[model samples]
Target chain A: MTDLNPSRMAMVPFVSVHDMMRIVNGDGVAETIAAIADRIEADFLRWEQFDKTPRVAAHSEEGVIELMPTSDGERYGFKYVNGHPANMGRGFQTVTAFGVLARVDNGYPILLSEMTVLTALRTAAASVVAARHLAPKDAKVMAMIGNGAQCEFQALAFHHVLGIEEVRLYDIDPAATSKAARNLAETDLRVVSCKTAEDAITGAQIITTCTADKKQATILTDNMVGTGVHLNAIGGDCPGKTELHRDILLRSDIFVEFPPQTRVEGEIQQLDADHPVTELWRVIAGKAEGRTSTSQITLFDSVGFATEDFSALCHVHEAALRTGFYLDLDMLADPDDPRDLFGMVARADT
Target chain B: MTDLNPSRMAMVPFVSVHDMMRIVNGDGVAETIAAIADRIEADFLRWEQFDKTPRVAAHSEEGVIELMPTSDGERYGFKYVNGHPANMGRGFQTVTAFGVLARVDNGYPILLSEMTVLTALRTAAASVVAARHLAPKDAKVMAMIGNGAQCEFQALAFHHVLGIEEVRLYDIDPAATSKAARNLAETDLRVVSCKTAEDAITGAQIITTCTADKKQATILTDNMVGTGVHLNAIGGDCPGKTELHRDILLRSDIFVEFPPQTRVEGEIQQLDADHPVTELWRVIAGKAEGRTSTSQITLFDSVGFATEDFSALCHVHEAALRTGFYLDLDMLADPDDPRDLFGMVARADT
Candidate 1:
């Protein structure tokens, strides 16, 4: 920054992974998820004010990297995230992310934060948000299929926010289920480690399928999903990858984040192009119906969206401010005279 | 970044504005521009290997914010930039930018750099690249129509690279011309500050126009341009902006970086949709002719491209490595167990 206008405009508050953990600890896990959910829901209600776009993705043989950008006329935010299926074998997370939030008026970034933890929190919060309006009024049990990285976050989020007392968990690899169960040992929720997807979904009002696969696989059959249950299909996100049988989608009232994107990447890709689905924002805003009857099967086809990331970044930004767990990065150059940038660089050392 | 892969994979090298100065001064400014131009040209030679896209811009009344992303199979890079002409009045730069270079294989950022200074360097380098191929062999004196932020850099680049012995400068405001003159006073090249645009182009064979404007405006006329001269039309960019006359465009043999983008944003937008123009990369690759005759008018319609930025980043990444002028940013999260992201956060406290 220059001599006259130095600190405020040039320095951006950056929250690292270490600081993210500290902030997460300062705010309890489930409570933070709920807080992000509240922000997501609030942003969803006023979705019309935003300039939205589907995440721009670059696909390679390894996996994919994506940039999700959105601006609410006032402030702009974007997340840079990658999904590499083989990363887990190399001791790397299948998905890692970071995000930035900038002012729309001057296009200056205000906050730069690690979003790996925040993405997990936001994904769970978004599920809870959809379940709030789509799930049964008296829902108490959540069956988590493919209990891996997102398992505990989802379980804790549902346990605290949706009043789910028990989580029935199952994964193809029994070791994963055991890890999730052990992690939830301290939590108040009753953790049930089941053997099969059918066993996992037994007597549960909400079922979450988030198995990781590079190719298409039906983790859940139509016979496994009962009426009056809310299904959160998360792992069938990219092309050529899906989790539920086509018949199951036929029976459920599908809700989506952004239909144009969800139609191409979500579980709904198995259905027709014009298949009627409710935009989740419309339901959140009360402009459309959620769950009409107890017999209705509701499914939130969750591929994730930019606005949810935007909401999460904003929520975490406020949390960082309150907790004082941020470092200022001198990422932008400011000169005494805007037109004399070369002169600033020339006289920098002096 | 974690314990197992903490040093190599966990920490990202971050170059700030102060360090960028160290780099520019360490390598003389003219030499740095020439090196960046070499990288840009090398990338241009292998342009087919890159995934290219025009920048995604979010426009507001105040200015516009843009994201320019590209990948060359092995590496990926993107820049975040904003153009707010009114920022100069508010004691802020009209344009500010930052960029990131990441491994395409795993999507981990290898370099994070402040591009405010680099952008100025890359812009000038790109111009000289065009002039080298399009300008006359005996071209000596260069005319600078806009003496703003980009003026002095252009003059120095041409002086060092193309052997432009003199620079004739002009701007609507005399102070801008004076500032540019003062900045270049230490150099060996003769600096002539002119009262009018016509006076500036009197004896120069190469002309550069980079005045800032938000709408369409003609800074140069067809009659003012002479035969055997090279025109570097840069000021008129964006959808509604251009700096050259339609008649001037008709007379000149135009060459552009990318035809699709130049058709919409460059000075060639004034010409017909099917007006014949040579792709600059083809010319660089020897697929097309550059200067058929010294008498022909050559115009390099320079709208900067993503590959140019990618080259600049790769170049600067190497330079920062050699100079050791970068800070390590703990921007990514690496957990021991790939699927145990929640566990990592839960245990980060200890």
Candidate 2:
């Protein structure tokens, strides 16, 4: 294999969902989350070099399909994600995604993996990465609002990445809350099921809202939040989907992924366009402050950025190669006779 | 298999590049070309219902990576393609691509295949579809400038779809011209290698320029273009990457797959944004006239639209299913407990 024939070089490796599941499972969730968080922070610090675009979305009656792409001269990563709110009714997930990472020099895919589980992992990793800088250092308790598929990842990430000792969970769906609780039953972190969103946030130093309704919903109002409560707002990503109340955004010191995208999709979308929100990368690069004072309210408005996917892709490319759990997809043409693609077809028949 | 459990009701077949090449070779190129051409034209006629967007591109110093996505309410398709002009120096093809087609209802990918070859096939099919409508009814000859990897597909498509009997080929690389000439030798259509671009277009009713330079190279200047010649501009797809002279665009009655995209990535990008160009769908829908007079020069400014991919995806989906040439990709999680993605991981490790 090291001889490096052009014909063998044409094959692209495809990482299946099963393969990705194995990689993540084999590596252990805590280690994978920590590794990806490190990657995200590293990628974010050098952010200006990337070619970024607000995702292109195709909206339908049921849901939306989006394509998010970014590149950094050397490699390009894109995630194809669909948000079908009604999919859960058919025993499918509300969000299902897959991503590709390619070498920009040759334009050949280096990684193709199921991002349904990986997205959950990266989103949680990103949230914790931001929270570590913005949340109080001694913050031991975290409140998680809207316990769904993403809830376990959030719970595990905060516990593993931020050293959160306790998690208070609440959701409209009791079954979803139970699922999160059952998933975390074997873990060391204490999981307390709360009756309501307010009950969950009562004594928690950090509040994480991850509700998935497409419509604007006030999961966290000003009355429910207090000083020094670091808010990690997820799930309020698309245009009309929001989680925090208007007053909560107005009162808190906010940090965001990309200002251009966060302004439209984050909790800050409820605020004015000129609102002085800190970019997360600036804090990672030591150019801006995070959690200025013990008593100051801080909010991490995370709508999931392409850079996080870029970082996760880099991590997965290395892991998949190390594990050799992927299949070699015949995804490119033979370079022996570049113009003889027709011959590939002709010879197959003969 | 037919008396399966309800969960396995409908199998969405997929075709890997290896299997697709086998199918194409087994069926014969002429037969495959005709079938693909038929699918393309039929799909083009119903283009109104499609969800179309200009491709999202991440451009680097050397090239660009783009995601072209579109849907027809029932099925969604997207192609990840890259154009690295410097890649040929690195012993890589200038363009490499792969794509997916998914059920809109379930957001489950039905077909995933290598588009490096399919792209060549579809791009040519699109040109032929446009030429069939935009070219003169009695057009029988084509002038193919920039005879490179795409020239064979163009020749075969034009021959099979537009009834083109002869092709005059010209390229900066004479070897490329000879390669194209040699590939088309097996076909009934006569291939003539010309010494210059002007000689190629001498008496042809249709002129197709499929050059590969990443810059604005004028393969067809206004002087070489005579009256009533339909220009199929196939290569000038990215911003600042153009093949035709601006004056040639100023003179011809242009038709495009998607006008907004053609304005930025096609030859029309050289013209003003306010330039009046008709959408090819309107002509296919019989709402507008095509090639009004034999003396009227009509041009199909092709940048390769996403809708064409949606059409091709459906064609591939059906073809692969009927022939049973697909690998089942474990891309989505159907947990025994749908909520227990972590359980899948835990079980895998055990």
Candidate 3:
């Protein structure tokens, strides 16, 4: 065999955090979120075509690491993400992710990308997509509790996709609120730094609770929330971790992504195993109702799903290729003689 | 946040295919196999400490892609691998893999390495580790039925770890046999290329079956096997895939990695659900017997477990850090303030 000169087939296109940030900033954060949201909505319509599996997670004392994999027959995608709220206190991001998309026919990875920035974008996009159906019509303000990594993205996505003009930010750490407030000031959306969660949600038709830390911590109580509010609950994602009070869950019309996972990880984990919740995809696909009554509270229990990541990955793969915002990573071994891997390695020495 | 200058912490050490070959050729195949075997043995001894899960697999008509994840409390590791026999006909590898090793405490990936070469080495090491206990004590001559990518690695591993002096190789494809024979010729061990499986196993104490691309095809029947021989069945992983006939499995004392997973994917898939197979860890841990009698036929139903990959990754993580045969990938977003993720991305525009 000829000496192993690695070819293009061996190189997977890798979009690092730098390029991911570039893709977000260059495309304009709101435009990127809207594009990804469109993909998410489109994929949601073809949900049955994809193989969906709940993320496999390893939970330790410090945090949890998860592998979320999904495939759409033609392509396969998976995200390696970690959630450690403690990480933030120690100068590490609370959540970080990377993903790979491979061709299902050959099982060769074609794209590798940092999903940190992209996940933030996707998470924000998912909320806006859900709110497009569930939020109170004429919703002008979004109350974003727990102003951290996802806060500004959520504000921008709402501004682009849902026509929300103002965002109210609140966090247990006032500094996090200031950081989020400062970032949102860069965008056209009016940013308000609230003193408390209750203050943030006041007069807001869409209240998004994304607080981190403390299992079973009720950031929003039944009395704190009024009627006709759409709640996008993205935190309290793991088992034994929940953010809402039980009374609030009983009053709301809940919607979830994959019941089995949502029951264990979402706010409904506080409720019964058989608590009725609408499938978000069904609502998006026009198979189920999203919001029917004017005075009804609709809650989107967003624990984050594989399909959302898969959708974002599909978008990034195409964008990276089109814009040349990726590096070729020599991640696979493609020998001239497929059966001569050892010979290829041996020849490499020469 | 300062304009996103990715720090060292943001970088993950990546061992690409080229560096993987350099590491393999730099360390020598036999020696590397032995070193990784030692790590596998050490990890197996503390087997109970690991959080073991059967690989999460997405099976398509063309092939299958699997994610194998395992954690040992402090550290986490996972491998992404795919198997498409048809890929070989299209000039792609039948199996390609890559893996990541991360700190469980902070949920940060420390190493990313091309696992195709490492997997070949680890697979061989695992077989040799099991054979050390189960193979005939005086085993010197070995027969490898499939002279494919793994054949040369298997020969070198056996030569270094088990002191095997000679190897007999055979493949349905004559060129594969010649390639394996040529690769083995470079080493001190004697190499014999044969046209048929029966001719290859003549007078051999250890018989290794590593053929691919078939479902339930019996490469080794009961009549071909002799008493007091060890069979390293490395192929036939995944459902509906088997190399040995039922009669051969009935006679041999079957040993497996993980029983629940093995019962579904290993040769034991052909056996009853209750078919008793000794866990290989017990034998290594001295809690169970290996080969009891001289005439006993020992068969290791190797489906390739996650711990084996985790052990290999741990080895690679250390080797890469030591030798610097790796690239530092800007895979993670390490913002100065964890809550300022949006600020970090926005500032990168400047």
Second chain TM-score, each model: 0.97, 0.95, 0.98
Show model 1 residue runs off by greater than 4 Å.
A1-6, B1-7
The true-versus-predicted C-alpha distance at residue B158 of model 3, in Å, is 0.8
* Whole-model lDDT values for every prediction: 0.90, 0.83, 0.92
Q: Would you list the clashing residue pairs of candidate 2?
A: none
Best by DockQ: 3
- Candidate 2: lDDT over CA atoms? 0.83
Distance from true location, Cα of B213 in model 2, Å: 2.2
* DockQ-based ranking: 3, 1, 2
Per-residue alpha-carbon lDDT of candidate 2 for residues B170-284, written as tens digits (9 for 90 to 100): 9988988887887788899988999998889988999999898878988887888889889999989989999999998888999998887889989988998999999998898
Least accurate 10 contiguous residues by lDDT in model 2 chain B: B1-10
**Candidate 2 ranges beyond 4 A from true positions:** A1-6, B1-14
TM-scores of the models, in the order given? 0.98, 0.94, 0.98
Clashes of each: 1, 0, 0
The i-RMS of candidate 1 is 1.4
lDDT of 2 by residue, A1-350 (tens): 11223366677777776788778888988889899999999998899988877888777888888888888878889888888888777767778788888988777887777787788899999999999899998999999998877888888889998899999999998888888898899999999999888889878999998888898998887888899889999989988889988998888999999889989888788887998999999999999999889888998999998889989988988999999988887677654556556655555532
lDDT per residue for candidate 3 within A223-336, as digits (tens), equals 998999999999878898888999999999999988989998999999999989999999999999999988999999999999999999999999999889999999999888
